[model samples]
Target: MRHVDPAGTGRAGAQAQPDDHPLPTPGTLPDTSVTDPAVNHHVNPRTDDLAVNPGTDPAVNPGANPGMNPERSSGTNSGVGRAVNPALNPAVDPDMNEVVGRDDLLLVTLDTLRYDVAAELAAQGRLPNLARHLPGGVWERRHAPGSFTYASHQAMFAGFLPTPATPGPHPRLFAARFAGSESTAAGTWVFDTPDLVGGLAKAGYHTACIGGVGFFNRRGALGSVLPGLFAESHWEPGFGVTSPTSFEEQVRRAEQVVAALPAGRRLFLFVNVSALHQPNWFHLPGATKEAGDSRETHAAALEYVDRHIGRLFAAASARRRCFAVVCSDHGTAYGDDGFTGHRIGHEAVWTVPYAHFFLDHGEPTT
Candidate 1:
């Protein structure tokens, strides 16, 4: 929320401003013993009051404790709700009642992306919008219950993602289920009934899935997995294509899906981006499908996918009431320990990126 003036005078040893604006060029470093000229001369236009009292610390009253301010302890501090309040509870309102209007959920699955790649892109500002929404936390370290896509997605919808190892086989499987299940539940399985998506639908959410992979596409029995998971689903022949034109087609269909949402109703949209899968050379700028490619080409494909993802977020932000979860079903191995793609026991095949973003909404508690 801060703003910086790019044309302002440089403070030799001062820290960079908190705004996204450009900063002045670095020159000779300033002497730490001397006060910064910018701080001494620069005047805040928003405030007219300026007082400098020698030998007095403004942060703490002289009559109060040296470590704590009496005003803050008495709840009489003027800066109570400002940025530096110690008692500010950012996560207290998880239901997001403070934000008015309808709420919607968007879950995006970017297939085959690794956690390292996501961190690199995020550091480079390629995902500036997503970075702004995140609270500077780790978004890629969450584990998947299964190394493969189908099994992992099944566990995700069931609300039992992978966690650290357990003591025994029974405990491991119990970790794979919805927590808080009664021992005398009707079902024979250790898992609890009603997955997250189903629970959302039962709570009046309109659930929909836009399939993207061969496992999700309506080719054989694999097609039934995704469709049965949602209230409505769509799978086309070009759904999982790796071509550039196919990417545009998928975006077009996504636009149509967003447009079809009824007014005054909350919707849950799940989409899988398949352009970064194997045979992804066509996603490059001048590459053709016939030309075999390597992991370098896959990186290019991921960059392209990032751009499209930015577009998707832009569209959803326009709606102003959407929550987005972007992650990979599983990672792909590019000859790491002699493994090619996923479905194998390789660290590269299991460590995938995961990011959650909420637009005009607070964190999701359910």
Candidate 2:
């Protein structure tokens, strides 16, 4: 319930003292060696037991692992609870066990990206790298759990990601045990812990947080709450919302971390891409601060992110397979109904873009 400023402004990088770690200039090459700075949804009325089609059930699927238990075969770390049944979860692929926990997990939050902007960018070919991994070659429209960074991300870490715009029990990809939860399907990876971060750690995955935006700057107790959940968390001056090259810096760090994680161990990497946040005019050529951030600038910011995100996907999937979730925490307002920012209820502030996909094992895609 911490109140966060929707407008990420001058003090966004408070934790990273400029004197100690100078922020990188827009055109400067990313400094991969920079030191660490600080630290779904659905509804439905169905019960836990579901009658999945036997023909499509992993228990009967020839491609499923023969020794894996269909009930517990969520393909997650051993510490997690068994999924009810993958057969009932359309989100869970029948061949999920073939890749699930066998690969690394990556979650990228495109902070404040609107569903319309992202969809348009993808359709216009401005987000080629990201579009390639989208489930249907486009971003899915969804409702954010919260209207602002802190609230939305809090729900997210606790397994309440954006729910599909559609109605009636959209099965979750992951969930924690709780009574009266109608969205937990057979394919949902039910974790015993209260939060997904802790759940993954218990399952023996190395969890890391590469933060962006003011909420993740760790400048105060409120900021520390989210990143503190991870085994390792990082933040830097260049990684905040104010930086024009934040996504580049973020991807560079992701490459370094992915390369350095312990061999043979799984990784749960979460990155909050700050480039899409406010003060994004820099992404537009010759655009001055006076332009005051608009949807056009927002799309440009996404294009900037797309230009470098492939390297991150490549790095994470280089050795083992990688499952990625890319979505915005929430959308922002650009004078829509006279609303200039988020934190208040509005269509522009509620609707977000979401997508999930897999990267197969191979050398990084250059």
Candidate 3:
């Protein structure tokens, strides 16, 4: 559970030759002094003409006037300035808009991560790959819409986020649409329509869910609460709270799902990991079942979970068609403020870790 600042803030091809365009090669230090002639070529004709003016002494121009350009006189200024070629700046390219829109999106839910823990782990390099991918991409203090999984997830599906403690005067709509409202012809809902998964599907994106919590297992009428939102959903055997390898197994299945997707189709995948939820004692290597509830046990569980999270990220990167959103459904209380577990109104139970990362895509824009 690590928190980093959110700052200002793909693909394809095949047999095509490596882009001859000069890009900073990965794993190599960039030479600051070197400039690409194609990108940084500067020619000021006015300055050139002034430099060759016969009245000025060439020796004086170079040696006497340190600040002035050799081609221009100290007293006179030229209006002409260097202009960047449109071809060199990607921002101005028409194709750039298309490229940005076509990239994939990934969203993850880290079932009960705390903000403080997430920050500690992130700072300690427990999540190096994620750190590298998203240097300033973490937001720690986000408010969960609900205090527990079922309620909070319902809000999430409806696009209603917990109201930020330091909220602005403007009313923000959490879900794409409000609940019990009609949808426009564009498929945009006026109110919450199941959840964002359903909205995405209506928008022509294939939706998939890899659920871990019992509420999402679709075992009975209760399972229908959220699983139906996705086009395909899975909850394997040994995936319940009693199972130890639940999180890892889910990641393995997620990798398989991504591999099996039809080529060239847009996809939306959501996963809920259960390892860090509660009864985290089994996460430690040699700790016996008798191990008491302690911070050490929590740390061990988090570390184990972090390893699996790293695996999921690696798999997504390999597929080159995913974006990940890693966050917590809610925070669990650990005897802080006289509170023992979650589903209570303690700061520890309210504040959770939330972060979003994209694969093979640049920073997001408004």
TM-score of each: 0.61, 0.77, 0.63
Which RMSD values do the candidates have, in order? 22.6, 12.7, 21.9
Which pairs of residues have clashing backbones in candidate 2? Answer: 40-161, 43-169, 85-186, 85-187
lDDT by candidate, in order shown? 0.52, 0.71, 0.53
Candidate 1 segments whose C-alpha is farther than 4 A from its true place: 1-102, 128-134, 137-139, 161-193, 286-291, 317-320, 361-366
In candidate 3, which residue ranges exceed 4 Å CA deviation? 1-101, 137-139, 162-165, 169-174, 178-194, 317-321, 361-366
1 or 2, greater by lDDT: 2
lDDT for model 3, please: 0.53
Give the per-residue Cα lDDT of candidate 1 at 8: 27
Model 1 clashing residue pairs (backbone): none
For lDDT, the strongest prediction is 2
lDDT of 1 by residue, 98-188 (tens): 2111356777877766666666767777655456655574454655567777888887676554432233211111111333432111111
